[model samples]
Target: MMLENSKYLFDRAQKFIPGGVNSPARAFKSVGGTPVFFDKAKGSILTDVDGKDYIDYVGSWGPMILGHAYEPVIKAVQETAAHSTSFGAPTEIEVEMAELVKRMVPGVDKIRMVNSGTEACMSAIRVARGYTGRDKIIKFEGNYHGHGDSFLIKAGSGALTLGSPSSPGVTKGTAKDTLVADYNDLHSVKELLNTHKDEVAAIIVEPVAGNMGCIPPAPGFLNGLRDLCDAHDTVLIFDEVMTGFRVAKGGAQERYGVTTDLVTYGKIIGAGLPVGAFGGKKAVMDVVSPVGPVYQAGTLSGNPLAMAAGFALLSELQDKPVHYDQLEEKTTYLFNGLKKVFDKWDVPVHINRVGSMISVFFTDEEVVNYQTANTTDKELFRDFFHEMLQRGIYLPPSPFESWFLANSLTQDMIDKTVAAADKSIEAALESSKVDSK
Candidate 1:
């Protein structure tokens, strides 16, 4: 594909925006080459600034589960914007959105809205500390809970893609309190709890771990965490920023049949808008401001526009329970297609998928945790990503990130994506052979 416009724009963007992109992943550093600037997106396709159209699989990092520029969400935003945007006061729409969330999510009784996933996670931890009266917290190595100062230690996704899991500027005091554990390894967490004991406030995790390429908890991992937390009086937190509403109606807590004391939500909840929320049992949530002592606030926390879009999206989801079924079928179809195609070429790739979230790791070893996920042949993945891009497919620009499937993708779109992967697999194979020689 020609990239005259995109290339020109990227050059200009670099002069103004650091590294020519607002987000690190958009720089395409992990996948190689300049990032394609999108002009518009509709349903399952993204059109680049240069007029090149490609099947979109990233889905705006999981918020576009209903697909880009969904009619209901767009219309709701438009209609709500006309009524005035941010009042900085309480709104009925906010209550409606909260009600919908409480009804859909398994354990939430009261929710506090935040501006982004990062804020939601950061504030949730503070609430857990205040509720439990403990200081230390345990987080998994690869499960990113957004860029809260504490979470930046051994984080995944954009942090890992940029070659720095431990970002600088985070204080030593913050890092000391944030203990690291391995994902899918109950023993690791057990060891942390054994050492920290009563000092641990909460154990937070990405229930389906989309940041490190969609690694699900090994069989009994989540259950084990719940048990450990209960025994130790530690709060269990599910960071469902990516999995909430995408994996299941009640999020990972429902999908995995596990209930957490607190859950953080983002992405899909906003219906592609910038919104996030955290909530749990009423007792714990009452600790938040206005109701209790722990304070947190945001000007656009429950903005009318965000509430309207989210309400429309959730209403459609709740009304049409078949949306989940359709997503699973489509995802399975694509998963099986990729598996068959890669196996036929004798490629040793492990694809991890749960619900609509998935990722193809360029490794023969099973990717159950951060260590295994890091063993992927990143150069091979870069080649595969570029090849897919050339074939009119827009994948997550980083090897570590998961590919999110939107409900708007048709069977034809999935088939086209599989076809592109078939070609891309061969390209990756050739590149591997050349590197080995």
Candidate 2:
């Protein structure tokens, strides 16, 4: 629990690296603390710079599904690196990876590899616009599809209106092309579609929302989107960067039984490496360059190292369906344990989960969308987060991100986590009472 070294690193990182962290969230601005710098991780245990070990639930934000330092993934990366990393052209592993994805995923007939989820999404939207000859797209609120300019948009005063740029760099022109809709609300989407008519080229969603704390699609929501897309002749894109292989072998589309026109993937595909892809119905993907007019290219698009690691990891998941089931069991154990603790404390919390992805919101209201998800008591969560960290349990630093459980977690580790939660809650509640006093 002694984070002296972490504190030192943070100070140095701030002077050299902006905010001492590459990512804004990692700066611990939300949770108000020093972010622990990790030295190494094995299985479910993370060894911080000071050598403090905590059971990991972040799972590198959802790519280390099988766990950190997993032999297969590590071995694949090492072996592939021996043959040199980037070819800048074509390789057999990339083809194997794409073929595997097409086989495992439901609707992907042809796929194109990209460097990151943002690239995949950006490319996909371009393709949708090219194919449909339209310039606008609709995206659900609170869905994080990376830092793509188009994705960084805020709802403009009301639903059924053009969005405004959330970030300073994004132009009004970019924002105007993106429309924001309410998650889990088909009425909002229908309203936008009606207003926009054939102007919208595509609709992108996070299928199982992770950014606004793991909100699942409402009943018939995905199907509703499917029908609407078909009716409008608009392409539907599921940004499965988080849910791709983590929810199920086939992802949210398979889990919900609703397929999309195009799907973008990241996270699990690279086995924690920086890789992403977009693919779906052959007719639509055929619009991309080398085959069609739409141009999307990356020098390191199919980096051999990432492809090798991804293929190795995905092949395991494909061969052993039990990994997903075991992950579900472990996640359920944690969820139920946390629920019991909260119930015993008479603390009303909203826990939304889809398969292994889950989030704990400090609110009694059902977290069906971003607005409801915002009702969470931030102070309470911040207190709980610090207490959990002190007790060797690492949760996502923010209340809005999902806690990804790795199957590497054992029953003992889970029990220990529950016990930690019990004590942590008691201490956190006491702190809250003192702060109020």
Candidate 3:
């Protein structure tokens, strides 16, 4: 648990990188510590610079579904790299990747690749606006669709963790067009649609919310959105960046039996590489540049390395669809084990899980949405996080983020995690009591 090396690296990183981390979540600011600098990771274990090993659950923020350095994906990247990297033009692998996506995903007739989830979402919003000829887009509170200017208002994930749901750089004009709604509350969406009427372009949501800690959509919540969008002629967008490929073969849309007008993907789609995509019905996607006039382009959009890696990972997932079931079973085992530990320790906690995405909120209240998710005692979670880290279990630094379990995690790892939780919960509770005294 000694983070001396990590501390040194953090200090060095701070001299160059903002907050000593490229991503705010990596700073461990909310959890109160210097972030661990990993030397390498393989399977479910992350080896830090100091050579300490911990069972990993963050999974590089949801991309390492098959686990870090998965052989097939790595091999694909290596082979593709031997040929070349970015062409800035077109490659056959890109077409193969797109075709594979269309085959696996439910409603993706056509797709456009992007460098990141943020780009995918931002581009999707533009397509929505161009197709509908409307300005406003409705996004649920705590449903982070990346750092796009339009998506910053009431955003979650890093924004929520950093206590700035709306960043300052986002102009008022952009904010005005992005309406925020309460997740799991259909009435809030109805109110926005009623007020905005035909002016709204799209309604975007994380089908199974991962940013606000894996809050599954309430019963009929997604279907409700679908119905409302159908009635209002507004595009329905599912920001499946975290859940795609990991939750199921086709993602939340397949798992829930709900089709969306557009779907944005990241994480598992790239198989730990930096890649993203937005796809939907042919008609809606046809509006994007060269086809109709929504201009969105990326120099490295379909970099050969990314396409090969993504295709390799996805092909495996497609071939062995049972991996999804295995992942869910493992997650359920871990969840139940953790629950038993909390119960045994008399620790008040609420757990929310869907497929392999899960969260442990240090509160008794059910975490159905961002507001309820925020009710969890941050101090308690901070204590729990450190305690678990000390015991060789690495959880997401912030409670607002979901813990993505990888297929690489074995029963032994789950058992160890549960055992760690047992001790960590007691230690955390003891620390809270000591602080109160």
Candidate topping TM-score: 3
Candidate 2 vs candidate 3: the lDDT winner is 3
What C-alpha lDDT values do all the predictions have?
A: 0.91, 0.89, 0.93
Q: List model 1 lDDT by residue over 1-437, tens digit each.
A: 58899999999998999999987867788877888998999999999988889999999899888899999999999998998989999999999999999889888999998988999999999999999999999999988988889899999999988889998899999999999999999998999999887999999999999988989878989999999999999999999999998899888898889999999988678887888999999989999998899999998898788889889998888889899999999999999999999899988889999999999997889999999999998988888898999999999998899999999999999999999999998987898799899
Clashing pairs in 3: none
**Model 3, range 1-437, lDDT digits (tens) per residue?**
68999999899999998899898878798999889899999999999999999999999999899899999998999998988888899999999999999999999999999989999999999999999999999999999999989999999999999898889999999989999999999999999999999999999999999987889999999999999999999999999999888789999999999999999987567787888999999999999998988999899999898899999999999999989989989999999999899899888889999999999998889999989999999999999999999999999999899999999999999999999998998899999999999
Instruction: Give per-candidate clash totals.
Output: 0, 2, 0
> How close is every model to the real structure, measured as TM-score?
0.98, 0.97, 0.99
TM value for model 2: 0.97
Runs of candidate 1 with Cα error greater than 4 angstroms are 435-437
Estimate candidate 3's alpha-carbon lDDT, on a 0 to 1 scale: 0.93
- Write the residue-wise lDDT of candidate 2 on 362-431 in tens digits: 9989999878987888889999999999999998888888889988999999999999999998998999
Error of 1 at 288 (Å): 0.5
What C-alpha lDDT does candidate 1 achieve relative to the native structure? 0.91
Q: Which ten residues in a row have the lowest lDDT in candidate 3?
A: 266-275
